[model samples]
Target: MSAARIFAVMVKEFTQLTRDRLTYALILVMPIVQLLLFGYAINNDPHHLPTAVLIQDDSAFARSTLGAIAHTDYFDIVETARTPAELTQAMARGRVQFTITIPGDFTRRVVRGDRAQILVEADASDPSATGAAVAALAGLPQEALKRDLLGAVAPARAAAPPFEVVVHRRYNPEAIAAYNIVPGLLGVILSMTLVMMTALGVTREYERGTMESLLATPVKPIEVMIGKLAPYVLVGLIQTVVILALARVLFDVPMAGGWGVLSVGTMLFIVGSLALGFLLSTVARTQLQAMQMSVFYILPSILLSGFMFPFRGMPDWAQWIGTIIPVTHFLRVVRGALLKGLGFADLWQSLGALSLFVVVVVSLAMARYRTTLD
Candidate 1:
């Protein structure tokens, strides 16, 4: 190519970019924002994980053990569980990430200089979140005993500590990466397909000039939006079944939860995804712009949805940003249901949030829809 022709093309592209300030801003500023979000937000070594305690013993030693876990930033003891059911419920609700079950005889065994066991139930459905926190527990007693053993009648300082921390990694005993990733793929895939499909569907109507004809037929905006979105629910179901089947057959991923529960949650998430696509369609004048916006949304879906990394590994601010993302909530629903056998009681929070997303996005799409035929 001639140097003069190359320069002319470059100048023409710059002029076009200047005319489209929004696209230019996204090109320049999006990368910087994405870097800050991914760099400062993501943390492989998650800390201060919300935790609950099941105290079986009322003894001083047991109290000391609780304090020691709470003292570290690795575990944030949110509440005390009165029974095993409460702890399980907490796990299902995503209220607590871990459960520290101090057996009833723990204090007695420790005082008697016998081997005592403390069970730490970790929701290892996402192994990365628990890996560092579980590894940090090895020296927990050493930290606890530093205060307790000031003048203890128990085992001396040089002797082996009488307690053993038993970490029971629930749902993912082997810590297989596939077990975590397989379920997450459902949400990621659903978001990508549902959003892009609906966005392209509506944009294609604009490209074909059928939108003006439809708008002239007295069809309400909400009705048109609903009509465009309804077919995608069936499509989402087919995709969900295929992905789940592949996960079970190829990766041996377990589906401990009820099918009914998983189906309902998946439906809500799918509806939300389609609603978002409808919203994006109203903002995009062309199919190409719709595709670009879908890609922009996909970035957050992959990065902030706990698919590429641990959800809790990110800083609190990033997590708050993640909270508003529909895919993030769907990931929790899928993982909790398939891995933990979580029922409505445990998954209602995410399901509710996803439902709200559908409502809000559909409302926005309805409001943004242009009823006038051009």
Candidate 2:
């Protein structure tokens, strides 16, 4: 390329970028915003998780154990449950994240030099939160037992079995972060690339006056939409396969669920993303504006979709905002399937949400799309 040609192209590109205020703002502001949000707002550590106590044995030993747990700042005793059924109900309603059920015979068994069993039930929907809570609880009884055992036996024997801590990492036994994040990134990557590509694709045709020529042909609106979406759907599938393969080979991430299920889930996500792009294209007057709209949509999808940050860590308002993004639902489905090996029964809500989004967005785009530019 000649120097003059390169300079002209550069000038055109800079002018295009300058014309799109949203894209310019996103390019300048998104990185800083993401850094601040992810650095300060996202914490993997779970603290002061709400917990219910069912202390049937209200003795010195039970009280001591409860005190130890409470003093550690890990468990906030929100309420007292009278029965296991009540505890279960509380957990199901998400009123309590964990429940400590100290059996009626807890003190009697401990005092009699017999083993005492305390049942701990934790909601593991948010794996990071559940893991931290479980770890804190696991150390409690052991510390209490150590204190008691040391007083009984001088310098505690070398082979002493003080108290057994059985930790059942619910939902995910291994507690792998990649198992959650990798699948979620699939949705994020697809939404970011596919939406931008499609949005710009139609807008570019409009900028070049090619859309008019194309519409003058026999192609119907729906047919045009289909033809435009088809190639990007294939691209989305290719990206999915590459991501899955990389996750498996490089990250040792297991495909715990069937590929068929993943394929369908990914297709739904792509449809939603493409529909969003098409909608943006209908409103955007130029390719630069289309790109800007894509960026405006993508930033929230990345930040709020739980791709780079833990969803539970975000504030209630932020989480509610996240619920509106198509990528958020897609992430839930992908992560649930890939990590938890969740079936259709487990992921039906997410899939249903994506389906609804696709319908709404595509319908709006079709309605807005005019064959004749007025």
Name the candidate that leads on TM-score.
Answer: 1
* lDDT (0 to 1) per candidate: 0.86, 0.75
For residues 53-94, write the lDDT of model 2, one tens digit per residue: 898988767777778778877678898998878986676445
Measured by TM-score, how close is model 2 to the native structure? 0.72
Whole-model lDDT, model 1: 0.86
TM-score of each: 0.94, 0.72
Indicate which candidate wins on lDDT.
1
RMSD of each: 1.9, 5.8
Cα displacement (angstroms), candidate 1, residue 236, comes to 1.7
Candidate 1, residue 298: the lDDT equals 91
Stretches of candidate 1 off by over 4 Å are 150-158
